[model samples]
Target: MAEKLSSSPPARNIFQRLPLLGTGGVVLTMAIAVMGIVQGLRTISPWLRIGNNQAKAEISTLVVQQIRAVSELTTTIFAMETVVPTSQERQWGNFTLGRTDLLYIGYGEVRAGIDLAEINEQSIQQQGETLIVTLPPPQILDQKIDVERSRIYHYDRGFLNLGPDTVPELQTLAQRQTLAKITAAACDQGILNQANQKAEVALASLLKNTGHRQVEIKTTNPTVCAIPSAQGLSRDKING
Candidate 1:
């Protein structure tokens, strides 16, 4: 009789062979696998961080460009009427000959805003997922005296018209003075501060819409409000 052939057992894979190890060996093997996985993650971490940094940089650049395109962002307008009194006196050797008193009412407007064109990459910063934007100081954008709404409320050439015949000059002076006073008043009323606050709110909203979930808007202390020169003399003067 021919010898009967016996079938051999199938070979076990490494995973199947793991049970052949004692408890201590099994623990050691598992620990080594865990270490390998950790090592792989450690090696990949720096590249992931580098990628994140690059994306943040690109976002910052795009934000700056969008802000620059907005140009001047006017935030506040202060409008009011002020009474201005101007007088020209005629004198003769320390003795008052007469005085021309002009009482004028003037309406003026002061506009304040941020010049977005001044923003650049340096103005923006990234802190993790949050973005920080530093805005330029607010400035007096424009000052104007409304000639249509302004007029000479009272005029007197004191006592027999002894005062100088300077109607046009007095009116022009009143307009100029009105503009200066209005600008000063606006500054005192914290118009720049108001502009800064409004700008923050506006920018926060804008950046959020651009997919930035966390954003911080910051502003610098406003510089001295430089009153605009009297260039509106021709247009601001009241017709006498």
Candidate 2:
């Protein structure tokens, strides 16, 4: 005898019915890959943040350098030489070494200018849009003897040259004297005045970048910015 079939369908494992080779399977795999990438980014988030902050700090430092324009301005205006006579004699034990006579032509360079670096918080005052800066006094920045440009026009070593060769000493003395003379001459010729005027112009231009439409430069106590006096020696004696 034959039996009648039931109307309901048979049940199966859910895993067995899942799509394995079609678009649905591919979509699920892609979703999992996206989730993995997101997790990786989260793990390195702190390191990425540190890198970004460091880059920003470096850029800010560069910006400051560009803004502090001409904080120190130096001027080399005059380079010249003078011819002078100098002599030196040395004594060792009981014997006089020997004397040296030198006619030295030395190149003297005068470095005179105002240092804007001297500008302090007190030096600069703001009144509305104008900037008032009290500049330091103009003075001789430096006095140098150019060895390469200098030469001994004449050198005389005493008879038989008993003393240690004093040519170098005489040369050095001549250079020292020449520099003093140059400084005095520059002062007489108004080098300091010129430097002060130039400072005003240069600093005004530099401060323009600092957002100040107007800059007023004034000098502090005007000092006796002349070369300190030293006895000028001639033929081993003070030139009276």
Candidate 3:
């Protein structure tokens, strides 16, 4: 007698009887929708940026006008570069077991300007078409190292070579040194004087826009633009 053959498995149906999405079609459709939404958002991102920037600038202008009046409508920004070296050592029984040594050629920038906020109604003198504004002494407004552009130019890990792993510490130390050095150098270069002169020109133009045809900005030099060490420090002997 012949034996009956076993029945084969049924083929999968590409389309199910369910409404709307069927056979995992909903997942595919949802993914496509999400991608389209993301693309649309990206296309409009630039406009959003422009709107935010304009709003911020407008707000800044209003606030400045209220606080500073028409005395200092502009500021002078100064930039400079400096290099700093950092070294640290771990010793055992008067013998150096590990040492981390690195030299960073840092690029730092600083801004100095006369504080217009110091100007009040008393500081402004009006005589016919001429307006005289007495500005406060210039000061260091901001200072920071450009970490993205500044980097290690040279390094020595000594014989043990433990520095490769502690690079973050070296970077932090270098940044601090670089800021101090750059600020000192800039001060020695008479950056305050430069800021004063530039500020005068900028304020004059700003005053013109505020209905003052002839504007004069004046300020006295401070007793100390920078500390005593600033003059002593230079690129040639910065390490000292």
Candidate 4:
């Protein structure tokens, strides 16, 4: 009966009380800890996402620079032979004074391609893992007559030298005409289309080789083929 002799033992410390927490209590404690860690992560997730997006943006910029470094890409070549008949006539008021006739057999080439230097950051876009590149329109890059392969097949002064002695002039005219004709023919034969197709294929291969697994190439319609003519030459100067 001295001080009622209390039967209750001393209170357990946190470490000692942990063992009294049975399966359900232990599970609840773990859940609470997990939730706290998740909350901490959530607090910093926005910055993490921003950093990831920034890294991707930088990579896309570098890719754009790499593409623009390719400069000009020649994709297709059109070569053919043409026969051009050019003539000149001088008239004196209801009477033909003189005439010159020249037959030219010319071999020419037309080059069609894209100028990659025109590519800019705007031309390229990235979506997840794929890249979309919009290329410049295909155009006539170069056209020329092969001087060594071209020649004046025939020259006629027309009726006892009544025509002007303009061998060199007529040859020059024929060459200019040859270039125009070949360029027109090339355009008619789908040179621009060929350039576009080949360019797409070539770039796809190039991008794939550079570690791009998915790439889409887009092209623009070609401009009209230009027919070159002498600046001051008149219709009267060219009879044919």
Candidate 5:
């Protein structure tokens, strides 16, 4: 009738008419997601910091242990070199031969007494200055031998007798004994000198190996110092 009132389709619902409401809901979801991510990062940050601190402490402890170990090794080596003799001297033999006249022919033999004296460790320590070592006292070994002989010879109606003669033998023996004594003395002196040189070398090597150097302390309350690195500060090097 009245031109059918020219009616359009029934009015749309508010939910369908306002498309921006859907967009607003999507924005709110995105904001919530961003907030969740930020919270997760905050929760993990403290654990990462704690792990980093623990690693740094372990590294410092290891360095200190290495230094102490090296020091102890150096000390032990020095003691050994100072206390032990590099060379030793020993008496080999001593003997005498003689002829005597008791029967048709006779022979006698005599052996010289040997006395060995070793330089004590105390003496070595007193002479040395580089290191201290404990050493036992010197010991002496002695040996001696004695013999007698007589000989007689008969020719026609006369008898000839012989006795031991030891003057020339004693002179030669004395010369050999003096040479041996000189050799022993020389050996002792040489060994002591070698010990001192060895100690010097050990000390030098220890210093070099340990990188012995003066370090300036940056803080005293917590005992902190700057660690030298090829590239400025340690933090900068690590971060870069």
Candidate 6:
């Protein structure tokens, strides 16, 4: 019997080792791909952070612009004049004259009459609102006086007369009427001034209130990022 050579361990072949080597290589490649992905994420984080900061800055700028716009609108409204009629002609009624045979009676009747006192009084109750003065109906003041009378007759039937005995009373009434008109005008002016002051005060109060509310919102409910940035994560890790 021929002595059989101990069979050497089956020679390892490149083909047989290929699958193992390829698997190892694939694992290494996967590790490198993972590392590259991590690096890419690290690099993009800073750009994302910059973009977020820019967005925040843009939002802050828009907020400021809106606030300025509101402020400007408030100021314009405050400076605007009320539409109330200030002219005397528009406030007062029309005047008419009638002549009689013996005496001429000049009657001043206002088509519309405005009572400033009433307006002012109403303003006391309704603050911060404009009040318009409206005139009432025209008041009639009649004056009759004799024009010509004959003296030849003992009982002089014809005589120059101005009007009835109430002519003096009418004159006095006219004076009072004129004075009242002047007083009303002054009162109206005062009321308008007071209303404007109140409006300004209200506007200031509104601005202050709005600012305080915004501050409270900022302090009590602070904004926080839902997902922390990579930089923030690095900072936390370093701190830890």
Ten-residue region with minimum lDDT total, candidate 1: 1-10
lDDT of 4 by residue, 1-240 (tens): 644454333333555766776766989999999999999999988866766557666766776777777777889999889998989887889899889899999888888998888887678777767888898999888777777788889999889889888888888788777777887889899999899999998887767754566989999888886556633333432323
Ranking by TM-score, best first? 4, 1, 3, 2, 6, 5
Model 3: residues with Cα > 4 Å off, grouped in runs:
1-74, 162-165, 209-213, 226-240
Candidate 1 Cα deviation (angstroms), residue 90:
2.3
What are the Cα lDDT values of the candidates? 0.85, 0.68, 0.67, 0.79, 0.31, 0.30
Off by more than 4 A, model 5: 1-19, 40-48, 51-53, 65-240
Those runs of model 6 whose alpha carbons end farther than 4 Å from true positions after fitting are: 1-9, 12-15, 51-53, 64-213, 216-240
Q: Tens digit of lDDT per residue, candidate 5, span 1-240?
A: 555554433344564767888889999999999999999999998866765445444544543444345432211110010011111112235432223211122221111111112112221221112322222221111111111221123222112322243333332233233223332333344433343344344434543442334221111121111122222212221111
Query: What CA RMSD would you report for each candidate?
Result: 8.4, 12.2, 28.1, 7.2, 23.7, 26.6
Looking at candidate 5, the ten consecutive residues that score lowest on lDDT are: 76-85
lDDT of 2 by residue, 83-170 (tens): 9798767778776778768899988678788765565555656666676777788877767667777889998776886535677677
Superposed Cα deviation of residue 112, candidate 4 (Å): 0.6
- Candidate 2 C-alpha error for residue 88, in Å: 3.4
TM-score per candidate: 0.71, 0.59, 0.60, 0.73, 0.25, 0.27
User: Candidate 4 — which residues are off by over 4 angstroms?
Assistant: 1-45, 48-53, 230-240
Q: Which candidate ranks first by lDDT, i.e. highest?
A: 1
Name the better of 2 and 6 by TM-score. 2
lDDT of 4 at 2: 47
lDDT of 2 at 144: 69
Residue 147, candidate 6: C-alpha displacement in angstroms: 40
Q: Which candidate number maximizes TM-score? A: 4
- Candidate 2, which segments miss by more than 4 Å at Cα? 1-71, 89-99, 158-165, 226-240
